[model samples]
Target chain A: MTDRPLDPAVLTPDQARALFRAGLSVPTAGWCAGRTQANLIAVPREHAYDFLLFAQRNPKPCPVLDVTEPGAVSTRVFAGDLRTDLPAYVVYEHGEPVAEVADATEYWRDDLVAFLIGCSFTFENALLGAGVPVRHIEQGRNVPMYRTSRPCRRAGAIGGPLVVSMRPIPAEQVADAVRVTARYPSVHGAPVHVGDPSELGIADLDAPDFGDPVDVRLGEVPVFWACGVTPQAAVMASRPKFAIGHAPGHMAITDARDCDYIVP
Target chain B: MTDRPLDPAVLTPDQARALFRAGLSVPTAGWCAGRTQANLIAVPREHAYDFLLFAQRNPKPCPVLDVTEPGAVSTRVFAGDLRTDLPAYVVYEHGEPVAEVADATEYWRDDLVAFLIGCSFTFENALLGAGVPVRHIEQGRNVPMYRTSRPCRRAGAIGGPLVVSMRPIPAEQVADAVRVTARYPSVHGAPVHVGDPSELGIADLDAPDFGDPVDVRLGEVPVFWACGVTPQAAVMASRPKFAIGHAPGHMAITDARDCDYIVP
Candidate 1:
């Protein structure tokens, strides 16, 4: 079957989800322009409480937008089927990636609880709107994410180092970026660290634990925000028997708007 | 044993908790002046996920501060023992109030999960600091709280109408009150309804579902904020088999400062 001619940036959230449901696989960065995109994670019921508590304790890295009831597929924010609508899925077993599949239906469980976490994409758009340059997007690369020395508060069996994503902001625009992004607390909020990466024990900016690296110009400063990968890091460390996540850069387009999460 | 002479308003949080733990029972409104006071709710592990989901869905009425592990009695926010640290406790049997006691150690269960929710006491101080008169405090009465017509989003078995606490603010200072309180989102940030009582389906201004009613003067407008009583209302409506909460007005004093919750 041939894919439809579509401009992801102009498509409505429902249209994007429909396209994804029809098996068109693509990263969701520019999709459904004004809507919020979410990172997905599904874990068995036995581990749901721990994961929820972990997210509660480490809210910066896990700003949960919505959590589906055990075994349920849809939520108020995401009207599409959880098992098949996302462009890509990563299935984990005992903390290790066992498969990357286009459809998660066969891996889905009756007792699974899904969490839709806020992504930095929302804040990046806000940053750009506020005239703050986003290095990764400008370079046409992924944001660089690093595992930090600081450990998140542990909840039950879930515990791991905090992870952060970095962006090089022009010296004068640093404050503007912070003010703009701080408005979206659900989407990682303000920068976790500014100026130095060593403070977070991130020794090298060029070698990120995940995502691609970007150049930091002489007049720019590297600012870091809490990354959504922290929860996945905890899942890896704690080794839950089963877990499912959207592949990096592939997000669940939700019905909620970017402005829905903005604080006054 | 003779009670020690102390000004409740001047005591530190640790001191306040010690006083309560030593069997002194009093409302915590004036205690721990700069620190945050939290509402307590403990339920069986079987019902924890639903309660957490409920809090997540209805953040305005149920701003969660900290949640303890099942069977645990302490958190980073509240270092004191949960079962005995509060000034008063109310035990619930099938959502009906079964007992109100000074100490809850006798009824505490090993499988209970405790949730510490943000209370309006924090924002009330901010309002007073912002030159907004809180009539209930001046009259030495409990802040009036009402059950509203609006229903909170349901999560699993936990769902109920939104509950709001009213304060009479002079029309001129309404904006100031909103700006000051909005800074503290964890404590039910900003007013949910302003001006008309009929809008919220609150039939009488003098009668409230909880707390004592305060007089709304001619130039003063009634401003309603999402109340901490909401989760308890849900508990009563859902009728869980067993639950425990701090008796109304009595609270668990936590280590976090009220300023720690304020946003830019």
Candidate 2:
């Protein structure tokens, strides 16, 4: 397939699923523009309880979109073939990445369950639509994400520190930025912290645990929202026997729009 | 124990826990006036994922307040002893109610985990404060709840219909009612359906599945909000080996106030 900019409007859910299945589309971040893109995770049935509890305990970071039946792929909320829908899959064994593959259909097991977690892209779109500038998007860089000292309450087997993504916003538009993003609670909701990075135990703004760091110019306050990487961190810390997640930027684009997930 | 009207203002968290421990307060709805209360559910660790997914799928009805660590009694958000915090609890054995106990400490196993779900009382207080009269409260009866034809998306072993509570509000106050309740997303968020009972599959407003029927006076529309009974219905349908929940009207009073859960 050629490296052409995909138009989300013309693409059907089946077509999107097919492209993902064939590895034609890579990262789903900007592919389906207005649609709700979800973070993916597959874990053994035994750890489902702890993982779900962890998500519940830290909702802002892990806003669960839908959880599939044990060993089942079809999700009612997303309505897609999880086995072949996503473009890329990262298989983790004992909390370490073992391989990156095009599909998990080959590794399908009866004891594995899939979880679709709300991604920040949904809220980012809302911010952009409301005329609030997202620094990472403008700079053509990945959003800077940091692991904070904030500890997430532990469940049976899952627990870790909260991870947050920073977006530099002008001081004057801070309240507006909050109000716009607050409407989409299903996707990491409002700002978790505003102003200082040092307050969250970060020694430097230039270095992030994941993603690229952007410049924080004059009159800009670094606003932080809970990042989707939190569940991955929890999964790593828990070190389950088996786990699978989407590659860093690769996401599953669902039929539902960003507007559908907004509470208002 | 004497049946004395409990003063909500003067009751400390310890006093409330003690009263509940001694079975002096059977129903906690009106016991503590100014305090926030939570709906309780205790399930074996194995079913935690299903229960958490059930809450996520049915957020309007099962807004989660806090989830406890497996085998642990305290919730970080609520801050209390779960065993003695609630007035009464009903233990279910494979979907059948077997006992109503004052404290769950005896039956508490290391494999049992607890969840504190948001209750509508918080939003009801906000509505009443805004001059929107709550009919059931005025008539001295439990709020009317009904099981709709709407089916909740299945998650693991949990699946059931969406249950909602109805409140009759003057036509002019519908918007105000929505605006006030929308701020409290932790407690059922906004009205799921406004103005019509038939739209929600209720043929007669005079009869309800649970709680007492309220008078729908002239010029008043029956507005419905998802109720906390949804998880109980799901639990009954799934028939897990062991399940525990607070008896209707009996709730766990928390250290957090109603205002604490509200979004600005």
Candidate 3:
């Protein structure tokens, strides 16, 4: 497969799902603009109860949009099979990643239950529209995510530190960004922390635990929002016997509109 | 046990829970007025996924505050044990009510998961404070609830007609009641239907599926809000081998304040 991504900017949800179904693996950052995209997580039916409980306890980091019946193919959020609808899938066995596949057909199992969790794409659009500049978007890079010291409420075997994505904003627009994103609770809600990275036990802004590091210019303060990856981190920490997730950036596109999810 | 309910107006949470725990199996209405009250539903671990899914699918009718760890006695919402803290419990075997007991300690099992679902009591206070008189309160009777033709979003085995509580709102103040109660989404949010009872397939305002019927006076309209009892109705419809629920009007009081759950 070529390294080039098909221009997903103009594709509709149906078209995008079809494209991904054909085994294209690419970041979904700019695809289906104005629509809600989701981070996908799949776990065995036995472990699903714990994962759902974990999401409920830590809603900000794991806003559950839709959950599928065990081994069920389609979800209400997206009318596509979980196994073949994603651009890329990361298979984890006993909490360790074994392969990154375009289609998870080979890894699919009867007891696997898939979950569509809210992603930050919706809020990020709100931020951009509100004129709150996202530094990573400006640099055309993945958002810098950090492993925060703040621990999420534990549920059964799944428990870990809250992971957050940092976006540097002009000090003046910090309140606007918070207010804009706060309207969409299903999509990571509001900034979990602002100003000091040290408060979250994050040492240097240039060094992130995941994703590419973006520079924080003078007069700009770093703002952190709960990331959807927190659930993945929990799954890894717990060392689940079997797990499946969308490769970072290769998210599942949903038919839901971003405006519909806005809480008043 | 006596038929008389304690004068709950002055009792604290701890005192109220203790009263109920000591075998005072009376209706919890008007007791623990300031704190939040919840409808209790307990199901075996094997069927917990469906119950949780049912709540997520029909959040308006089942605003879940907390779910206990399977076979765990206490919950985050209320510190009291699920087995013996409640004054009234309706035990079900294969979906049929087998008995109503003051204490369910004998039926307790390591596999039972109790759910704390939000009730409309919090919003009722808001409605009264907003000067929207609740007719049932005026009549000193239980709120009138009906089984509506409207069906809830089904999840797995749980599917049933929505059950709603009707409050007679003066024609002039129906909108005000909605606005006031709309502020609390954790409760039933806003009115699902206003004015005509026939629209919801409710045959008569005087006949309710549950609770005592309150009269709809000449200039007043029947307002329907999704009731927490809808989940219980669903549970009964699914007919799991074992289930436990609080008898109607007997609720569990929690430490949370009504103001804290206000979305805005």
Candidate 4:
């Protein structure tokens, strides 16, 4: 752990997946520095349309990168198999997580459809490139997230509150942060709210709904962007009979460049 | 008739829709100046998933703006009814046009799902705003379009060749045309091809497959853009048992402003 760089200069995307496949269930953050990582969700074919529509309707929360064909384990960008490539997966049944597994091969079903959603890692890289300090990365912690009062636009059987990830930026640097992230819409583009925590029904900055809270320094404002974990919230609220997702902070690394998602 | 401004400075979106609803069958191109106009496609809900997937897969050819809920005639942005809003519709039965109707109410089924796709008219506005001459508009004719050799990525049962609309631009203004239209990805972004007809397998510039040809003056280059009408090609090739689409050049005008589609 001491030898590993906080941000690796460069690494092969396959190397990360290979380690995960060999049962090294470590968090994939800080590895494969310039590549795109993604959140994974697998639902039955019956609910696939609704999930796709849900992501389309609320793109800020669920900017989809690739959707695997129904019952198929292959994806467009990643050579890794969806069923067992990730380090960990959380299985959900009727809205509750039933188990966390290193590989979901045993739980795989022919009726399942998988989706790879854009992870905030891409935009965080953009922000970092612009010299904006991501407090979580600086402090070596997960980005703090909160469930907002704003309801996501509904799609068929899927709808829930929007979840947002927060990063504190120096007052003068907030605009630059927004401008940089805005370029990457496929990876949770632009901030949803800036300045107020209560507006999102968030209270007590130190206590976040998910992830460890990084300290907000004086002269800094907490900025919120729609989170990639939102689909998990939607899955929970909708209480689909069966679902599978990568455990939070444990994501699937793909063979895509982070800069490929930049719009302008 | 002489008093009516063909380019009405201020026509309410509803007024034009009312005309279409009241048995007035006419092209909508010049009627709504500042609003977003879209191409319409309706298919049975049974095949809607495949169609939606196909559009997502081939976005340059089919940039979907809004999709109606299954069995519903209303859309999110368009004020007019899908069944009667557009002045005319071409009903397709197993891939070929069976009838051109003033209204599709009689053809509408409970299982029908409608999608509104971005029309190139939006980017044409951007180009015109940037002082890039559009030869077809100046000549008062349809923009020339051709089916290209490039095949659209298949989704489910839908797959076909890419269809592109062409506009001849003064060679000197070609960069400005590209720069302006690049802002509007929803309306097929920048030109797919810039100088050569042979590159796209088009035998002659004067012989367009779909629309009336306009003159390409000397020192001008033909610019090709991904056409919204490509979905009709896919619908025809896939030969779904039933489908409905707007007649070529007849579009559904929506309440959204055209500039709203600008990506930057």
Instruction: Compute the lDDT of residue B215 as modeled in candidate 3.
Output: 83
| Structural RMSD, model 3 | 2.3
Docking class of 1: medium
Preferred candidate (DockQ higher): 2 or 4: 2
Compared with the true structure, what per-residue lDDT tens digits does model 1 show for residues A148-168? 999999988889899898999
Off by over 4 Å in 4: A1-9, B1-5
| lDDT-best of 1 and 3 | 1
Candidate 4 C-alpha lDDT tens digits along B174-214: 99988888777767887888989888999988888777889
The true-versus-predicted C-alpha distance at residue A18 of model 4, in Å, is 1.1
lDDT of 4: 0.83
What does candidate 3's lDDT look like per residue over B1-264, in tens digits? 754554675677788888788888766666776788888899998888888888887878888889998888888778887787887888988888899998999987789999898888777777878888977767767777888889998888878889898988899999898888877776888888988889899998787877888888899888889988887788677788898998776788888878866765
- For every prediction, compared with the true complex, DockQ reads 0.63, 0.58, 0.44, 0.47
In candidate 1, what are the lDDT values of residues B1-264, reduced to their tens digit?
A: 227446677888888888888888876775778899998999999999899989999988888899998899998899999988898998999999899988899999999999999998897777778788978878877788899999999988888899898999999999999898888887899899998998999999899988788899999999999988888888888999999998877889999999988875
Q: Any runs in candidate 2 off by more than 4 Å, and if so which?
A: A6-15, B9-12, B30-34, B101-110, B195-207
Tens-digit per-residue lDDT, B1-264, candidate 2: 536444654777667777767766454555455577888888997888778878877888898888877788887756677876677778888987788887777877788778888888777777878999988878867778888888887876888888898999999999999999988888898988997788888888889887788899999999998888788777877799998888766778887788877775
Best-matching candidate per DockQ: 1
- Report lDDT (Cα) of residue A88, candidate 2: 78
**Model 3 chain B lDDT-worst window of ten:** B1-10
